[model samples]
Target: MTADPKSSPLFSFGVPALFVWLWSTGFIGAKYGLPYAEPFTLLLIRMLLTLVLLGVLARLLKARWPGWRGAGHLAVTGLLVHGCYLGGVYYAIQGGMPSGIISLIVGLQPLVTSAVAIMVLNEKVSVRQWLGLVLGLVGVCLVLLEKFGLNDTSGGFPAWTLIWAALSLGGISLGTVYQKRRGTGADLVSGTIIQYMAAASFFAVGAFAFETREVEWALPLVLSMAWLVFGVSIGAILLLMWLIRRGAASQVASLFYLVPPVTALEAFILFDERLGLLAMAGGCLSIAGVAMVVMRPPPVNKQ
Candidate 1:
């Protein structure tokens, strides 16, 4: 008996599913992480610690470092995925937009990534993917519309929230495209460690330059910071790298569409947020669309 290549390793898809779930929970992670430390300071420390942890892990595993040539390539990844995108989103969440809203909005990353892939990566997408993109957009729109209540006073969120959300999506799409064009330089552990450190550096620099308000001290805050470090940065990233390494980029990114709904579900379950009609519908639509687009197997290699 022989293994079927058509299976494409269930773990590849499985890992991304878990990755999105954890990512959905990242809102909770950020919400908890921010109270104790400034955003920049928090991100900075998270990256630094991740780098150290990865370094030790690599050393034990006898990891190979790609050295300086790899560093430049890694820097770009850090900037888009970690620095601009994450930095913008975290600060926005800290600034006040709800995590659910942000996830719903950021869910557009796959659609954007698809467009970019067509234009830049020269990757061919099926009509199904385009349909999926539209359906996903509608779902996102439903989620956004729910944010409004009939009340007239303060009836809307800060305009900047949209800007920040867009920035986050834009960064991620650009980052994905960049990765497709330029494969990573260092090994997963090393790549992540370096990428995170770069992001952390940006945050640290920002904290020193801009943060002014006093931060509260407490156990929850300490725990939150630790969670961001070990849980989100370390845990989630490794899972992400695993998925990317094992699966096609389209297949891997499609999993991100699941993040919003799953995160919303978690928020409702754990945080007592409402599971509204819009959220439910949007979740379904987004999932369906993503599946259609991602599940379409890439053109079979010609013999």
Candidate 2:
């Protein structure tokens, strides 16, 4: 059987790098947009715009809409992946959790996903894969340590907010497995449209109930929202779903280990954030760990 076009070689080498680059910009986008609007408010706008833009693209491409069952599955996955996960992170950050601390906490998603995949998806994980997960985690922690050290967080962050961050990690972890298990064969463009619509509803409720819904309407905020809507939300997510469909859930989750380091680099270039030698070493370790998981040995056939 041939691989789906979405799962072809283009994804093998190029997609991961492009996805990482696009995904990393999400941090930058949040940084730019958050000052102008409340967390849920900002997310609501981004989700709405993402829906509109993707809807247009889906029509232009004449994308096939999933049946009701697939649409429901995708919507639920969207709630977890986009709504709960992003809501937690944004809320935690808005409530004063440092971005570095949040990133470190969320970086644990691979291990969580691996554990869940083992139990729920009945996936067999090798010792090498476990080692890669741990190594990647350690690498991320080291990079965060250099950037944050013990002093990364100040005193005022609420315990509940940290819990929210953890919830975000869980959301994404479970969402990946759910996507793989239930959403493997869905149409990308239309499925994503349903997802954003569902996610937008989630955030819209929060924005209306909890937020004052004020937006500064600054050029920076507008630009950030545009990038997030078209670039990260659409581009990065399509790549993510493609990866999940193409590889093991654990391996797909491992890719997230690259995010913090990549984001660190982006911050360095864009915002002049520090990227010390220790951070570089940690980044290398992260890469090596991802390789171990992603580049598994081919199956040996016994005649």
Candidate 3:
């Protein structure tokens, strides 16, 4: 008997939605952790723990190791995905850019990814998908408009901070496409172990160069590190790699459009941030666009 595709451990049901929610929480975890440590230092700790955990998991699972060339590619992709992306984000937040503004800037990533995928990966996007991308971006703006209001009162962000955030947008977008093109054959656990190790090295260098490498080890900081390392760097990232390998890059990137709204809702519940009706409507619009982009049409039949 043929097995159901959704039943596969990699493509299990609700994985996409689960990924978005978990990924969004990384920002929250950062907010929690950053108070007790510098950006590079905090990330160095998370990356090191993630590397050790993934390495052990890879060994126990007897996961296949990539060949030398594939290992190189995985490391490069990790530099972009984990190193550049998180480095940019953490540095920006530390530099005093409001998370709301940074998120808004990062919201441009789907459109950027779609264009890059067409050029780099030769992935053709349907007009409907393009429309969906636009609608999703608009919805993100609507949802985040109130947050921007907070930013205005928060004072001006340094130009370099914006640059770092923009680099993060580029990092994740290209990293996804890079993995789809280059890292497809590697087993998840082994590949992820290498990725985290490389990312840890990157952050360690940054910490030594820029930070005091001090951590308070407070309860919230330790808990935040654990959540980010295990919950985000492992679980959400594995799901992301699986999705990118199986889906069109454009389609996969479109899912990021939903992240801001989801993160906003998470903020509401966790931090008691206000959730307005306008934001709800915008969230609905963003979800509608995601559905349009990801839900494939039924296959045509010839008589």
Candidate 4:
């Protein structure tokens, strides 16, 4: 019988690569969409649209729904992974924290996830993996170093905004470990539907409570919404859940190290952003770091 292509090495590597690329575009999408809508309002619309699309998909695919207990677990994951992480990021940026600073703050996810995983999941991290995590963080710092012109302060950096960024970091790091610990074995499609429902409700509340809920609905906003809803919320998120189910939490979190570098490249291409040599070097280090964390050693031959 022919080997299942899903088990191929290419599939393993390709899926993560695709997830990184798609996730990076989220920054680009937010940049395009945020101009036309408040952050909470924009996320509210995106989550609702994602729910509608996923609902239809679940119906067509006859996806299995988790039990109520499983659904509650998924809801918690959603609140942390989608609600806190995305909401915090948007609020921080809206509150005038530079994107580079926010990225660096949130880019600490791998280290945080690894640390939490050790305690929560009792997952073992080799020294090599620890080194990789540290290197990845250093790489992210280098990539974003030029953008750290905190001296300017013309954008009015509120000290409180750092709290939002820190919330984002904590949410994603804890969320990954939580998912690895409690989110396994659920149906990806239906479980993710539950997740989106919870996240949508969170954003909806934020929109009503805080945002004006005014959306300009221009072409750029529309395109950004479409991409974020279909490409990121659906595509990349599903891949993330799949990876979490199949890999260690720390291993999966390492993939996030690539996001800032990839986002920088996307911004450079789409928004005419400058890429310094340090950023290029940092990108290389991030790639190497992730490879170390994710790559497993070959089996030794037994005599």
Candidate 5:
């Protein structure tokens, strides 16, 4: 008998929603987590804790590890996606690039991923998806222009911040394509442990070399660390891995397009940041682009 499709309906759609929610909350978690520990140091701790918890969870579920075969690929994936991408983002935020602007910058990831996929994955993207990508790019520019005035509060997007943001976006885009290029079917839990461990190594070196990271052990700091370990490292990363395994990488990444608006909402409530209607308009554009791209039919096989 023909086996059930890999992406059964119940799990497939729900995965994206979970990915969005886990990722959305992570922005706030980062805001809380990074202030206490240095950026690279915090990431190392998160990655370290992520692997530990993933191992336990995997053992509980008896999830089979992919063994050494997938190790190198997972290592490279983690270095690019988590290590470089998050390292840059955290560095930028540490320099006072507002989370909204950070969102706008990193939020363009879906469009960038599409471009990389075209070259790397040889994925067929329809003209409609192309238009959606264009819209997303325009939306990102609008959000940046409207909110992050040319001269930001913190030294007007230092040269390093701009370059780091670009590299971060590139890392994420390349990671998306790489994941597709490598193909997915390995056990998600086992795969994530490898990825986190890889990221942990990169960040550990960064932490030891560059950062003072002499953080005092306070109750709030310790609590924030726990939240980040659970919320972002374990929750967001695992959901992302599962989604990539189950569906189109680009389609899975569309949910990340929601991160900008969700982050804005959280910023407003938590940080007392203002997001005017114009900013919200840009958010709507991003949401529209995501809808257009993800719902489009897959490319047909040529006769």
Candidate 6:
């Protein structure tokens, strides 16, 4: 009999690695696409495209739809996760907050998620996990310290933009805990479609109210949009939902700490960006911290 691929070590490692890689590309995609469209407009388009694709997939797979109560939970998650989180991110970037600063701000997610999970889900976090969370934050700060400049106006973004970043941090943190608490066990495809529908509605309202809704239709924008819709939205999000279903919320949130480091490496390879020694060390620390947080303790031997 064939072994279940999902039970293999490779599958376990590969899924998280793939998720981090895909999630990191979102920063690149936002940078690429934002020049051609306002944040809301760009996100609205992406969400609509994602919804269409997921809708088709759900139909083909005969995916089950959750009851209204379960769907309401999914919609709340969608608003918090996709709507507020992505909206804040894209808005901050569009308003000229450097992606590094934004990433650093949101990198606090694991800690925030742990706290929320404790209060909301009644999840117990050991002292080791708390240390790991702190270590991860320190590592992310080290990775991004070079990007900070007191004298640079580019670094001195408007106070409102910083609020957006804060909102984003809160959004994703709460959303992660909320998903673990209430959004699990639904059909992944159908649940995501509902989530995207909520997020799309959010973007539609924002786009109509705030943006001119003009799109330049350039090659970079087109490619970035395609990648965000297919790669990040569909692929990474499904993986995230699956991960959240299968793990402790705090452990799952720790995966986000790897994003900035992975994003730095991606920038280096794709854009000739240089990584300093501190950044490399920070990456190592982040990896170690995540390992500490996510690694299961060895089973105790019976006497």
Best by TM-score: 6
Q: What would the per-residue lDDT of candidate 6 be over residues 1-303, giving only the tens digit for each residue?
A: 999998687987789989999999999999999999999999999999998899899999999999999999999999999999999999998887888889988999999899989998999898888888899888888887753432354447877899899989999999999888899979999999999999999999999998899999999999999999999999999999999999999999999999999998988899888888888898989998998898777799999
lDDT of 5 at 31: 77
Poorly placed runs, candidate 1 (over 4 Å): 4-9, 147-155, 213-215, 246-250, 297-303
Q: Which stretches of candidate 3 lie over 4 Å from their true place?
A: 1-13, 150-155
Q: Model 3, residue 117: what's the lDDT? A: 92
lDDT of 1 at 188: 81
TM-score for each candidate, following the candidate numbering: 0.87, 0.94, 0.95, 0.96, 0.88, 0.96
Candidate with more favorable, higher TM-score: 1 or 5 = 5
Worst 10 residues of 3 by lDDT: 146-155
Pull out the clashing pairs in model 4: none
RMSD of each: 3.2, 2.2, 2.0, 1.7, 3.3, 1.6
Clashes of 5: 0
lDDT of each: 0.72, 0.89, 0.88, 0.90, 0.75, 0.92
Clashes found in each candidate (C-alpha, N, C closer than 3 A): 1, 0, 0, 0, 0, 0
In model 4, the runs with Cα more than 4 Å from the true position are 1-4, 147-156
User: What TM value does model 1 have?
Assistant: 0.87
Q: What lDDT tens digits, residue by residue, belong to model 1 across residues 34-54?
A: 877777777776677777888
Instruction: lDDT for model 6, please.
Output: 0.92
Q: How accurate is candidate 3 locally (lDDT)?
A: 0.88
Which has the better lDDT: candidate 2, or candidate 4? Answer: 4
TM-score of 3: 0.95
Instruction: Highest lDDT: give the candidate number.
Output: 6
Name every residue pair that clashes in candidate 5. none
